[model samples]
Target: MGRNTRKRRTPLAAKVVAGAAALAVGGGGLVWANFHASAHEEGPAHHRTRSAAAQVATIDCPDVGQQLSGVPDRARGEVDGELATMDSQITEAYQRLATTRRAQAGDPRFVQNTILGPLKDRRKAIIDRIQLEIDRAGGRADDNLDQLAGCQGRPAEQPQNGDGQNGDGQDGGGQDDGQNQDGGQNQDDNGNGAAGPVADDFIDINDVEPNSRDSENGLAANGDGGSTGTFTTDCGVNENNLFNSDNLIAAPGVDNGAHHVHDYVGNQDNDAFSSDEDLANADTSCRNQGDRSTYYWPVLRLQDGTEEFDANELGGGAEGNVGRILKPAQAELKFVGNQQGDVVAMPKFLRIITGDAKSFTNGDANANSSWSCTGFEDRQVTDKYPLCPEGSQVVRTSNFQSCWDGQNIDSANHRDHMAFVQEDGGCPNGFQAIPQLQVRLVYDIPTPTVENGQVRNPYAVDSFPEQLHKPITDHNDFINVMDEDLMNEVVDCINSGEDCQ
Candidate 1:
């Protein structure tokens, strides 16, 4: 039903080194182990060594899409199409890298010559086309796009966020020896399909320390002008099973723009080719007909060797994303008011993308989603997947950017049109506060067994194959389509400090 599973090596003796450096992967505070110590050593010494080159785990390429913020409106479509092609090129190159492990072991430069070299050449040509497209459309393109064409293999042990502290509000070096360094189970370098989601990517939720931080940036100075109202929308958790690999906001008109499957709720019509008119007139999964907005995010999967539809297709098993998909048990969509002042109505057809889909390599500048257990939500993580204890479920929460530029509905990079509330809980200059969208999803998953430095039946979120299915890469997308009357009603309700649905 899915791609052929690769053989996993028996884990070596798991050593407990107390307080080694833990790298925080994102701003959400999930610390990961950056130690290069080998697991196969029989030493009382605190450190072990493995071939650094052999630990090349995934591809690390610059995010070209995020950098093309100046693309002209007339050239956006073609440029976006080219960018999607670049993604496919990387996926194919990663597949080659995964299948050629034996060849790589035999020749040191096998990867550089046989994989990355060709990939860079292809990317360079695409960049040239993009530049020419912009030039023809009377816009100046960056002359140094070639710098973004070359990519290097990301080592498995690199530090996330380049910080020594974990994001869960604890010093990385303070964990007990019995605790997992990366806040997960033991270490097993081998991954499914020779790609990632290695055992170190998971952490016991109870192991994380409890800390409280403002989920939406900094706190307000005063509450005199704040809007304290709330609104709830009844959108079922994708019970209709609408799934696709397309992304209308980022890579419109290109199939499989996401390179991963997304669970869609709200608007029934959403795909690469769905137009704004099509969405406004389409059926919706939301109980309120006036709120025809669309919301979606990547689906989570259990690595339990079960096959479903699209198992062999692109963006699924073909792209190293295998296993049975897990549906969310509960989907809570709430719109809350700003902390410093009243929120205005969101413009119709406004698009927002919260979190970075490529944060595994692009760094955590835009990584905003957080993971936790049902009862332990006070402690949230961004990099490591939470291993929930019994009687608790896995939870993923996304709090969207609530500030709108009050001008364009969309931007070239798809992010400039929106901003997060400032630390003072007010919008930036020229921007106004809008109803902040908060998406909370809960999943009842069978916990994976991590024993003897190995994991079985581990669950992971869908990601680009080269991104290694890291939890830091989790993201969410939204489109506002509420009718004007309903939108105004929402604004009034929030301004009046009333909780209305």
Candidate 2:
């Protein structure tokens, strides 16, 4: 189809829009064009201006990958590769956006002309390739794929503490200027400043309302005919240093697909290039060798100046995800039965991704980030990084979907084949209940101090540079490579209501 022949989008009609204020880049600072007073409450749309300078926190682009649910099977690989390329383009553009403060100050249109414009162009070309791949494979590509090419700058929310400072403490900077001594954007020692985890991102657990779901933090209460048993897998806490940025399930054959390092446990050979056969024969990290499933999630980091091996590499410090990689104090992997009824054995090689890696800009629709202080697991928060009281550890939890479509091992989005249980605790119509994978990761680190608008010793999960390490972007990945016999055993254990390891 010709460029002019393609359908055009109606303003922001089909875009993954968020927030009440749209950022307009100008005068080296971001201008807020407020369309509404707040995002949560209903209000009349009106025009307003804020004189206070707002940070151009991150770039927001419509998530093309999420919308591609019909790519032909034969075209999936190429489409995935192009999608990975788009991610790299965004990372590069974000880097330039973060470092070009002076240029932006001089040219009101610098950010648009220099950063987002080129990014859109690059993404446009890639989107065309994706469309071609799908078309050639006999699938009708979305006519509006080109509409998703345009990108915009998103402003970061201001700090919530009212006071932004260091107090009477040493380094007595008193109040934050939101800039470093050199007039550049203030950043962590590893240079993650422009990307994020600002002081407002952390909230003391005490302040969070206790609103967690009843089923969270543990297996659900048994229901009539439900499998009440539990099965636990002993996967070490990634002590063997199994780490990578590849996501074979989402972007196979593409290196650095995740754009952030992951702490891997379970299958020993999981990577972008690993085929099903390679995984089946790979070494195992689980105590039970019959289970060679791969489980991985973004590594957590302490922004305390210590440099990890990947500190200067693409997925690490160079991409604004710097700091010392913190090892988990405890890694608990459990498979619990569904509350509706017995769960069937999960298909071998099934791929599942829980949570949204881009939730920072993508919004929390798919976000499964469950963070809390160890003793206060009952009050889990999704968006804010939990501030643990002294002596308390931080906890990260991922509750995987327990329902399946029964046929496909995976889907175009890697999500359609799986589904979460319904409110009544039953699988949706046409879906079969399966063992729910529950992961709880605990970290032992120094409590971050927030005072005078300054955060000290802050810790954040690794993320796509554009994601800014937001707590809501936290996610987990899993691929079931368990042998059929072992899988059957798990099903049997759960149905029998016996706890087994």
Candidate 3:
């Protein structure tokens, strides 16, 4: 299937220019072009106009191959030079901002302090742009030159098969003279048939019976001595033809937990609670609570069975089974990914504590199960421990902590409790356990802030002052403060002056 099917295009002059630029920048050290010209004669040879021929003669064109060859090295050099210039400028600007900041620390007139803000942001943007340009030009030039080299022919591949010669000094395909006597069967020199149809080794299907001993029916009859017509085989059945409801039967011993009917099939154990009894009890318990959170605790059994808690009882109400206690040593926490974060439905928070000692106050202790107390006062301690906090009715595990908020529980203090109990082992089993909690946080695009309003040079003495309220710096700020137009103008000037050295 090998074929030369690719279409080719005529190489353009612009490509040549680009190739040359690539080669110079990638291979040569030169960053800029140098053109030499003599000064024109005063008064243009006594005001005499030159002819078109003279003008053409005066114009000089460089060798295409030479120019293309130097492009890679030249491009690389230019990129490096530009980066260096940008870096120096950024550094200088940063220093100026820093100096201004130190001198005008509290001056109301210099309200927008330049030490660590907008100016620094601008410097960062310029540096970033310069770096991007350098990488693009240098990489393009190198790639072009490599491609050009491949386009030129390299070497040819060799054939692998060996020459043919029999040990008897005769051609490998040659026949013996004695074998050609009759040639009725077209025999070879070795007396073997060269051509003609031969009899098949096995009997034909037409000779065998349609329901004979070799068929599936035959095999079944022979195995059990039963009539083949009595049974029907599934020879023609396919996956698509199988009906979901056709062969279905009520599972055996479903009432005594011998078998289970899955949720999709309209079984009682369709939800977190194993049976309708548990769900009814839980629903009744929460009915009179009037806007309080409720949970269904799934208690797995030893024989792959499950039990559920009465929600109303768990919440200590009179409508149903209340004050239903769970033994901590026997109950393990369950984490449902999608259901964890719903406040009205699950009403639980999930958090994960890191094993790093630096993440907790009891750094010296084993932190594998410890919780975090960071931002406990503000109820925002979930940053370090992403799971539910303690004292908020959390379900404890070997590696994670979960909690439930009942009666306006302080989420932060709960987090603190989880962290403390995990490290110190103060929380005990049978201490009024709450349903295990799980929570997840989702984020959108980042918010804009003053620091990001402009690029900042960290080392500058007179950079823009960072905004007090915001943490992140953004793209718009960098553009507004940096002189992008001026930078572009410089680039254009250099590009237009092709004759400049």
Candidate 4:
């Protein structure tokens, strides 16, 4: 039987306030809280408080790989290998998050932006592979891990493509579609630089879990299976925009900080850097939607000189020593929730990020997150990229959690204020759970064209800038700019067991 047990999490001893410094063992230095309150999200940062009275922030994960025996016949060996890799990565991701929480006791936003968000994104590949292999083996894995991995049942299954050319790439996309395709071609041979890695269009979301089988009627999975309901929207024509250099935040002063732009979506006039007020007041392409939440992330390229993404140094690469950055295509932001209870309006300034910018930096090679052909989302062999069947385009699917600690909307780590939705689709006790939001991005990227020339990763996720046109570096963020009324509507919809557009 596959089951998980929650450990007794101890509460915090007391709350800390901003500017009121505390002491450390044998150390006497002020605990700095470097937070600037945004107009809409004004309040003391979570670093100055805790989720509850004396409750230390903690994340729990079940013992993975413990149910390998459940893996069926033919796929057993592959499933076992993938599960082991998955279990190790899952453990590291969670342990790393826990360690981060422990280390950055004062700043919760740092924990959220720095730990929780990145952990979820980095774990995407493992989660997908596990699901695929488990299904191939004819078994079900731990539901919690599946959800946490943000693994949706998948778009719909596809027959194995590419003649099985995974990584042994002696042939990625084996179709030579790299050289030609039906208008949706995503290759770069202009000579400025070679095209990046090639990927498939999609993997069946239904193969791993069936939508009809969702535990609750209105509740949809938060990517993976769960008792949560979900809906997505494109902020009208304002779906994509360029960032203002003045507001830029990542990749410190490079090229006199003149370039290195990012692609944005959500609020209009959003720049590289900005405050909650600027984001809220600015116009949005999200026409009718009353809730004025702002969402944006880095943009990818098509490398054919058509799309933007022309920055000299993309948003990441903090560790340096790399030629190209890896990324995924598309970043969808939507509201999802419990079928029975409505999610309380998220606090005005709840800042959230879903992936780490510096994730592929230095030695932190992302194990499996990357772009690929349709029906081959789980394959990791970089070079053996699969070729999609006709009518399919490459895409990246990302998800973000929606539960928040009632008292603290903004934590030092950004995550302390929020937690993953529980297996029951409810927020944890005392924590204010909001509707889970999911981000799904689709790209026009065709098959890989620039074979050995500029291709860097043969076993990696989508890399960036150099390979911008290749649909790499997919990430997302959001700030709850909704006032009381609109938020209440969101809550009402969820509590009533309904579907939202």
lDDT of every model, 2 decimals? 0.71, 0.71, 0.19, 0.37
How high is the lDDT of residue 132 in model 4?
77
lDDT of each residue in 341-429, candidate 3, tens digit only = 11112222222222221111112222232111222212221112112233332221222232223322222111322221222222233
Q: Estimate each model's TM-score.
A: 0.82, 0.83, 0.14, 0.46
Per-residue lDDT of model 2, residues 62-164, tens digit only: 7888888777889989888888878877776665665555555556677777777777888899999999999999999998888788777655552222111
Show the lowest summed lDDT stretch of 10 residues, model 1: 13-22
Candidate 3 RMSD computed on C-alpha atoms after optimal superposition onto the true structure = 40.8
Question: Mind giving the per-residue lDDT tens digits that candidate 1 earns over 1-501?
Answer: 221122222111101110111122221111122211123223442111112222445666788777777778999899988888788777766655644544555566776777778878888999999999999998999997777887666455565552212111211111122212222332333224234566677889988888744545322222446997878898898877888877889988876678789998898888878889989998898999998899999999876555557565566665656667888999998888887888888889999999988888788888886899999988888788999999999999888888999987888889988988887778899999999888899999988766554665678899887777889889999999999988998889888988899
Enumerate clash totals for all models, in the order shown.
5, 5, 68, 73
Question: Where does model 4 exceed 4 Å of error?
Answer: 1-232, 237-240, 244-261, 304-333, 339-342, 361-387, 423-430, 449-473
**Candidate 1 local Cα displacement, residue 31, angstroms:** 30
In the order shown, the candidates' Cα RMSDs to the true structure are: 11.2, 12.4, 40.8, 21.1
TM-score, predicted candidate 4 vs. hidden true structure: 0.46
lDDT of 3 at 292: 17
Clash count (model 4, backbone only): 73
